[model samples]
Target: MSLHIVGGLLIKRFGKTGIRSVNLLRFRLAQEFLLCFILTKNTFGKIINKTMSKKPSRFHVDESDLWCKNQCGFYGNTAWKGYCSVCYKSLTNRQQSSSHRVHQHASVEKAVSQRQATPELSYSKFADKRRQQSKTNPVKSLFKSTKKDKSEVDKTSSKGHHHLKSEFGAFLESLSRPIYEDISKRVQNFLSKFKLLPVNSTVETWSDAVQDFYQIITEHINVDPIYQTLEETAVENLQDQLEMYLMNRLYNVVFCPPNSNDEQEDLSLQKRIRSLHWVTIQQLEANVNDQDIGVRIALDKSIADIIELDTKTLPKDKLACIVESSRKIFDAFRLSNEKSEVDGGPQSVASADDFLPLFIFIILKANPPRLKSNINYITRFASPSRLNSGEGGYFFTNMCCVVDFIEKLNAESLNLSEEEFDSYMSGRTTAEGVNTVYVCDGLRLIHENNGMIRRLKERQEKYANSVLNLEHKLSEFREQFDEQINQLVLRAPLTLKPKRGKADIDLDHDIPHSLPSPILPQQISNSQI
Candidate 1:
């Protein structure tokens, strides 16, 4: 039966029961059931309508010609602006070419008009006029020379190309030790105050404090009499030095603050990367491989450099490590491409698309210690100008994007089936039947064995040389001994002496002589008698 009919019957029964509690409860339940049924019916209806209202396939033909409008005899579709894909592309190209031609014509006409409106002077005539002027006004020429020197000086100053060593020396001389000490002391005091705060404080608070201090120091450099003699560029450099000093002092407290989840995030990312150890170069479609020793070395060095970020205490040093690591990756690909060309393979330029996956792979493999904390620290505490632009900024941005990509990675990201990805993630299978963990372990073992073998060979060579030297020394000693024996035989003759008396004989050198003299008095008297 329909829910409406059941609901109506329940309500009618309730009315006939004279407002009994049980009847009222049954009526309420019937109302609730009817309301749910109505909602469910409307929802299903909308779904069916949506499914049925979908537009037909683009290739579905009505009364229109199934061929290209230009009569190219190729299949066409209205979705492609009523043209085949090729024709549409060609049409767009022709339009672009025509527009380019018109633009070039207009630019040429404008250039011709501009040329006609201005007076043209020949190079020789101009040179002659300059020579006559110089001859007529020697003082003017000297003034011009001075002006030219001044202009050159201005250019050099504007370009900020002053000799760094000289400028830095002058800056130090202008701002004496006392001034530098004061600035450092103030910075330390500011940092110490922040250090006294609870660990739960946000990184943004620290960043703002640092930035404000930076502005104050910059203003001081500009207005202080001690810094008045310094050049604008020197003042800027001093500001940079102040920033570095501040960050170095704050590195301990602000970076990976005690209350933040940075360490946990690092661990999670590291675990994720570990699980994805089976990812290979082929899957990433990167222009690198394990077979290329140079590429392998470059990748390994890059990983080492990135991992070294955790050890760096300064933001600038950390940035340098990141840049170095990125450069290694680029160099690896460029060298790989060159090698590929030499080997008769098609050459292609490596772009961000190729760089990203490889970099992501590097991050996954490196699994750098405190990866999240390092990235967050740099992003939050590093100089804003450094992160906003330039090569460092570009590469660091890429690093950030790669990290984010790794965090959000799924089967679709890797272009693998969901089931396959799940299997890999769950450790049920791996790429090419090789687990990444095992591969790393095996490589480490091989490296250790190679080092051991090399050491053993070196020791063997050293011992062999030692044995040869020992043998030569032994022979020399034998020769010297024989020569000495021969010389002794040639130079001296041996003789033996007979003993005159028993007491005189040296039968036992250890015994003393005149032993029985005192006790022999009576014996001597008896012998005499």
Candidate 2:
């Protein structure tokens, strides 16, 4: 059955046939070899087909590229050729995801193109549009439109606006309307009921009336049930309002200024008026010294109590209003040069300018934080010009001296004994006195310095101005000298006149007849000498 053995039998059988049968035997051997090759190829092809027909395991499928390359039983799509349909869809998101990315790119390109086309549009417009489109939802534009509508509605529904002048006018009207008549009447009735008023008391003795009212309230608070209801009365909260009213009236009567066209002057006047109370209170304290010690102490205590109570009790909004109104009024007062003779008997009142710094001091003590923000305003008001001038300078220096004293008073180490603290607060070793020493020392310091710093600053400014003026003068002198030199050079003869000969001088020439004696006129004369 071996090809070699079969071939040997055929050749032996053919050897007897001689040379004529040789060709025929060779052709038959060739046919047999071709048949053997065909059968072997068929058998191998069947085995290979059988092996490939079975599905590969997951491990084999992952490791071998041949299965996918041959498209063996895998049905999944692939992006590449010879891959399954499933793989192609997964790799490309069934091709739609790829189209979606392309679509997004196109949209971005379109937006960019739109932006580029309208180059005149500002960046804000593009930003606004982009912001509107930034939301992923399709309804974002609709929401934006609705939001815009709502904002428009809000704007349209708001209350009408009033200018500062108009508002100030309204406030003046309200103030002028007799708001205190009822309270004044109440005070009168209460005083008459108690028979506390003097036999011939009148509204002119209002201070006495107020004092008596306070004394009665203090005396009867525990003993009388009627007085215990003081807090429940309408007048309970009226004290602050009354105090503010009185202060306003005082400013109006004493320091009210005429209108000015200059805006800056107006602003300063307003600031000073706002600050009037500070100075007025200081003046009041000074006047208190003329009274008996008991009255002085009582007055000071009452003043302190009122101020402290107002600070604690007044609503923030009302306080802000009062402060703003005071500022406007102070601005008017600050520019005022006019002085009115106040009706009070015999005490010479200080000028409003003298009180300005004191007013600021009071503000600092009452509400330090409130003044913190307005420091710039205060500084501008107390600037070099104001400080170098008359009464303002005096007051400003005094205020600074006070500040220096306060700084010193607070200089003691943070760990202070109780007695030391009491002494510090009272401004004396005795517990009865409240810190008068600090104020007294500050006044003493003011007296000692006596506008020294202001004078120094004035000198410094003057020197600076003089230096600038000297520089200008020096420049002018140099310019004038240069001009004179240029004029002298222009006027100098460029060349000497040609010497005149006798015959040449006889010829009609443009020489002057009046020649100097130094020059020989006869030699140049037409006639011989």
lDDT of 1 at 178: 69
For each candidate in turn, the TM-score is 0.49, 0.18
Q: Write the per-residue lDDT of candidate 2 for residues 262-284, one digit (tens) a residue.
A: 33443543443343212223322
Can you give the lDDT of residue 433 in candidate 1?
Answer: 22
Candidate 2 stretches greater than 4 Å from native: 1-369, 381-384, 410-430, 433-529
Candidate 1 local distance difference test against the native: 0.67
Per-residue error (Å), model 2, residue 417? 10
Give lDDT tens digits, candidate 1, residues 65-182. Answer: 4445777655444333546444655686798899999999999999999788965668878999898655542211211235563343234232332453345345545676867666
Backbone clashes (count) for model 2:
27
Candidate 1, residue 155: the lDDT equals 43
